[model samples]
Structures are given as structure tokens and as C-alpha cells.
Target: MRDIYSNVLVKQSLTPAVRTATATGTAVDRNAGGGAMFQNALVVVTTGVITDATHTITVEDSADGTSYATVAAEYLQGTAPAIVAADDSKTYELGYLGRKRYLRVVSTVAGATTGGAVAALVVLSDPRVTPVVRA
Candidate 1:
């Protein structure tokens, strides 16, 4: 069992750049690691805004790549009131103790005409259910 992670970061970016102002991001796949399973995930969201904006970021999973759904048991820790500042950040810890085979992250921004930018980073710890590399 290899537990220590070094040299390589155990993280993935959901979107290439900050989400478009008042736009939603297309789901980006994270199962490329080819692992059979992962136990926990830490989703870090970085936000920058000029005025009021309601931004909600969530993590979703799927058995198949085409369909996705939010894990009902996990949620993120963030400020309840809408953020209307230059810099706002939060990290969500989620546990995927189910049999879902695929995962992705998404964001929703509202209440801003000229919205701000938001970025997401997900650090997933693979439990290595199978513990074997497949080609």
C-alpha cells in the first residue's frame, strides 16, 4: 500500500480557467487516474468579484460519463451570504463512499450583471479499492 504522495500533486483542476461571468462550466472528467475508487475529495474554490454575486460550487459524480448527480451526503463549507468582494475563497471536503465510477465539478453564478471570476481545484484521495494499475 503506497500512502505517501510526493513530487506529484494529488489534485485536478475542474476548469482550465475561471468560470465565465454568469456562466456554468461543462463537466470535466476526473476518472482519468484509472483508479477503481477514491474516498475523499477537497474542493477549493477561489473567487474574485467587483460587486454582489451569488456563486455556488458543487461536486457531482456519475456511474457513466454522460449523466451526473450531486452526492447527497456531502456539502461544502462557505459563507451563506453572497460574496461581493474582490477576493473570496472556500474549500469543501466531500466523502464519496459510494460506488460511483466518475466525478466532476460545477459552478453557478447569479446576482451579477457583470459577474466575476471563479476557479475550482479538487484534491481527491484514491483509496485504491483494486490497488492495481490497468492499461
Candidate 2:
């Protein structure tokens, strides 16, 4: 049995050059799967000018990146106040159940309108162990 250390496998910022209503969030390829490297994989997201309240965010996965599936979903709503601007960022954590190389985030609500603009931030990380066994 192979043992791997728990560390940040990948990290990236979700910044788009052209600000659009429909924009692809951050994504990362694990490239570590087969036996158990992906068994305890964890995904963490950090938002800026975005809050868990008033918006529904999710972490999606896909083998081909083009087609994706919702690995985990979270809806930020409750007693917390609505997130009006992109100044206060929130942190979200999620764990991967199955094997997936590609992962990304999708925002249902783009927050409130500010000067006719909407924005959101997403950070994705995949932490896993080592030594994946093949069938």
C-alpha cells in the first residue's frame, strides 16, 4: 500500500478577461486517480466580493471538461444578509466522493447589480493522497 501526504495538489484563481454574465469558473485536473489517490480528495473554494448568502454555488466535475456533473452543491441562504458587492469573500469546503479529474464552480445568482455590473469569485483546490492502484 502506498501512502501520500495531504497537501494542496493544485490552486488557481478564477479571473476572466472579459466580464460576462455567463463565464466559466475555476477548474483543476487531479490527474491522480485509479486506486485511492482520489478517495479522500477535498475541494475548497474561496470567494471575493461574493458571499455564501443570496447565491447558490456548486462544485461540478467532468471527465471531458465539456460535459460536467454536479459533484457537490451549496445554497447560501438563511439568516445571513445578502451579499451586495464583491468585497467580502467567503470560504466554502467540499469533498469528492468519486474519481474526477476536472472540477469547476457554477454560480446561480450573480449577486446584486452594481453600476449595471455583476461579479463573483471562486477558488478551487484538490487535495489527495498518492499511489493509485489500477484494476
Per lDDT, the best of the predicted structures is 1
Provide backbone clash counts, one per model: 0, 3
Residue 93 shift from truth in candidate 1, angstroms = 4.1
Residue-level lDDT tens digits of model 1 in 1-135: 564441112455445444435443454334434543455555555565434566656667677877878656534343222335444453344444555655566666667666556666655565544343333
| Inter-residue clash pairs, candidate 1 | none
Worst 10 residues of 1 by lDDT: 3-12
Off by over 4 Å in 1: 1-3, 6-13, 16-31, 34-36, 74-95, 129-135
Model 2 steric clash pairs: 35-133, 49-86, 49-87
Query: Which lDDT value does model 1 have at 109?
Result: 67
Give the runs in model 2 whose Cα sits over 4 Å from its true position: 1-7, 16-22, 32-39, 50-53, 72-87, 115-135
Clashes counted in candidate 2 amount to: 3
